[model samples]
Target: MATRVNVTVDAHLAIEVMLLTGTRNPQDAVELIVRDYLERAQRTEARTGDADDGRRSSDLQPYQPPQG
Candidate 1:
C-alpha cells in the first residue's frame, strides 16, 4: 500500500491546480502537478545532459592578447 502524505496549501493555489488538472480532488490535482513537473524535468535533463559532462572552469586559462 502506498503511504499517504498530507500537505497544506493556499486555497487559491489548490483551486488553480485543480482547474488546470481538471480534478475535483485536491490530492489528485496535486499528484498530477507533481508528476507533470517530474516528467518535464526528466525530459529537459535528457536533452541538456548533466552539467558535469561539460568542461570545468579550472580547465580554462587567462586570455592573452596577440602581439601584432
Candidate 2:
C-alpha cells in the first residue's frame, strides 16, 4: 500500500535533481530519494543494535548513483 503525499521544492532544486539523477519523471525522483534514505536508515538501525545483521560501518559506504 502507498499513501499520497505532497511536498514542495524549489524549481532550481528540482532541476538539479533531474540533472543529477537523469530521471525526468517526478515519481522517479521521489522514489530514488526514498530508497536512498531508507537504505541509510537501515544501516544506521543495524549499527545501533543488531549483532547478527552484520551491517557494520563499512557496509554503509556511500553509493554513487549511476547516471541514466
User: Highest TM-score: which candidate?
Assistant: 1
Q: What TM-score quantifies how close candidate 1 is to the native fold?
A: 0.75
lDDT of 2 by residue, 1-68 (tens): 88977888787877777777789976678678788999999999766877566767658879889999
Please provide TM-scores, in order, for all candidate models, with all chains considered together. Answer: 0.75, 0.57
Per-residue CA lDDT of model 1 for 1-68, tens digit only, reads 98988999899999999999999998899999999999999999888777687655557889999989
lDDT of 1 at 67: 83
Q: What is the lDDT of residue 18 in candidate 1?
A: 99
Instruction: For candidate 1, give the lDDT.
Output: 0.91
- Runs of candidate 2 with Cα error greater than 4 angstroms are 50-68
